[model samples]
Structures are given as structure tokens and as C-alpha cells.
Target: MNETTTIFGIRAVIEAIQNQKTIDKIYIQKGLSGHLFMELQQHLSGGEYNMSYVPVEKLNRLVKGNHQGVVAKISPVAFADLEEVVTASLEKDTKPLFLLLDQIDDVRNFGAIIRTAECCGVDGIVIQKKGGAPVTADTVKTSAGAIFKIPLIKVDHIKDAIYYMQASGIKVFAATEKTEDLLYSKDLNQPLALVMGNEGKGISPSVLKIVDEKAKLPILGTISSLNVSVACGAFLYEVVRQRL
Candidate 1:
């Protein structure tokens, strides 16, 4: 909450909601229960704003004054619709290139991937709405402002996004060690969606089934795998190389 843009009292936050301000997201102190809290709960359920429950220490760190436990943050970038991105990209004359992330939770890695994707001319990035890290100031700063320049699509289910891309004649490539296919062996010249999963679990099983191709980096070193962002750079630049 210390990183939040607006720190307000419970009443002030409720009033902000009532006044129809563009509240990006709201954080309420945990164990905050009462008529006012209940009223805020009902207001939040109406979907006018994004809200979450957090610890009281979080609120205290946000502000020194009596906050009464509520804070709101303004979103820096607008999210793109997954369906719209797929539809529009396929409609264009140029071949589409997408970077799909399954469950990446690291902010720095996410930002680095964005930077690489932008430099490599990826059309958009598809991230799981729930599991991905929040794109905060840290993300933007890490991306070196590439976050603003690139399009980001937050999807409820990543498999649905993959299916949408498949229906549009775009091939989906899953980057994982389990696959025998080497990255260079695949034809990256075609319209494609490259998927990279989280650090620990790799791609979720649900998303893995739909991937048209599974390719892995050629590991010649002692280490079995490269870092997620490093692998991402390799795959993205492979696309760039193929395109040229």
C-alpha cells in the first residue's frame, strides 16, 4: 500500500466511489467490519471499482494519519481485450506475433519480457489475469518505459486466448524443457503465439494441451534451463531473425 497513488480514509474512499471517480483498485484493511465496511462491501460488489482485503500494517505504511483503512491506486495503462486483439491482429495484412505468459509472478521478469517483446516487434502480450503480478511502478520502471509502448492483454483463462489465436490461424508455441523440438527447428516466419510459463511450475497443464508446438532452447551448458526472461529473449529474437 506504501506504493499506492492515493491514501484515503474509509469515508473518503466510499465518497470517491459514490462520485464516480476512476478508481483503479482499492485496498481495505483486513478485519475491518462494520456498517461502513458493509456499505463499502456492497458498493464494491456493484463493480464500480476493483477492491482487495489486506493487512492493517499495509494501510499504516501507506499513510501516517488516521486512514481508517482504505487506499486507492490509479492504473497507469489500459488493458486490451483478448478477443479483440486476436481478431484485429489476424485482420491486418501483416503476420501476427504474440507473447503469451501462463503464470509468471515476478515483476522484474515480466517487465524484462515486455522490453524484449517490444524490441522484437511482438504485437501483444497475453497474461493470466489472476496469477500474473500487478503491473505497478516497479514493472514500468524495469521495462524502461516499454510497458507503455507495448499492448498488454489480461485474460481470465489463458487456454481461451490460445484457442482464439488458433482459430485465427496463428500457431501457438509452448517453450518448455519437456519438449524435444528445438526452437530453431520451428518455422517462426508464420503468424505465431509464443508461450512461456512460470518459474516453478512451467506451463499449466490446461494450457499445455492446446499448444500447437512445444519448443525448447538448446541447452549445452551444465545448467538444464535458462532463466525465464533469458529464454524469452532467445525465443523473441528467433522470431525477429525469422521475420528478417
Candidate 2:
């Protein structure tokens, strides 16, 4: 974990709770129960902490401190709720410019993409909960804290996210060299989502099927493709250009 919080005794745990730190989970030593335990249990049950009981061995592995049977894992950053982000954008009466990254696993690429997206005034970024590169320490630092400013949502599947966007009247445009359809042919001024794929596989076939348009960057270079972030910039700039 990038960040951690340790509360040795029950009182410390209560203090942490009182301080309003978001706990990822909590570990209580095995065969533990008492008034203090009850207090801990009550506090945890009503709160967001994932609670569990573990042996002393696990607690020892966690730290060398004299933990009085409690350890809490702290999340580094708060997550962006998709509904709040989407609804707020709609409420603003502005076009929703969402960027959906399909399996872009490199941390550097992820950060660079975020940097570009934020620079282009993108409303939000969406990545799959599993396959995509998570916002790690590297991603955070690479983005230069822009990750904190822009909304990032992790979804189960890109296709499902796409479907929801379409239902909400957002058009999804897949930017890839595989498509002969030039980006300039389409109207990007509408509420739009740009899908940028992985470094190796590009967007999955499942995701591509649902895209409203497969728009390609006009490539006259000898190289076959542009980096995911570079192509993302191209697609995003086109949107900005059309909107302006």
C-alpha cells in the first residue's frame, strides 16, 4: 500500500475514526473480544472499513509495533464516483467530453494520457476496474497531481460503459489506425466519449462493436501507429477545435 495508518490500541482506532480517515480495511487479532472490542466492532460495523480477525502471525508481519489487536489500511486517494461526475457535467449544461481507456496498461502512458486529457479540458476519464493500469504512485506523480483534479472512474467493462454513455445520449468514438474512416469526417462537437486502446491489442473487439464511429488519425508517417496518448491528444484536440 502507498499509504498506511497504524493504531495499536482500541482508543487509537477510535481516534482514527474520529479524524475521518477512509480506512480500506481493518485487522483485529484472533480470539479478541471485550468492551474495547465491542466498541471497535460497533465503530467498524457502521463505517466503511472492511473488518476481519487474523492471527498474531499476520499482525507481526504487518508491523513490529505493539499493536493492541488493530491495524487499519488507508487508501491514498479518494475515488471518483461516476454518477456524481456524470450528473455534475450534465447539470453544468456542457458537452461531456469523457475519455475511456481500453486496457492501456503502462503507468507512464496512463499518466501522459491523463496529462493530455486534462490539458484538453476533458470532463472525466474512465478505465476498466481490472485490465487497465491503476492509478499507482507512478501514475500520480507522472500526472503531476492532475489525477486529483480530474474525475477517474473504473468500470467493469468498456462496452457496458459505452452502452450507458450512448443511452445517456453520448456518442463514443474509437480512435484507432485500424479504421480507414478519417476523424475529420465526423462531427465531434456532440456529447462525446473517445476510446483509446492498449499499447499492444488496441481496443477490444467487444468495445469496438459498440462504438458509434471508428475514427482514425490521418497518418502519413512511415510508422504504423501513434502512441496511445498522442492519438488521444489528436482526438481530443479535434473535439476542442470543433466545439470552439
Candidate 1 global lDDT: 0.82
Number of backbone clashes in candidate 2? 1
**CA RMSD of each candidate after superposition:** 3.2, 6.4
Give me the candidate number with maximum lDDT. Answer: 1
Candidate 2: deviation at residue 14, Å?
18
Model 2 clash pairs?
Answer: 8-68
Residue 28 of model 2 has an lDDT of: 87
Q: What is the lDDT of residue 59 in candidate 1?
A: 80
lDDT for each of the candidates? 0.82, 0.80
In TM-score terms, candidate 1 sits at 0.85
Runs of candidate 1 with Cα error greater than 4 angstroms are: 1-8, 11-26, 46-52
Lowest lDDT block of 10, candidate 2: 1-10
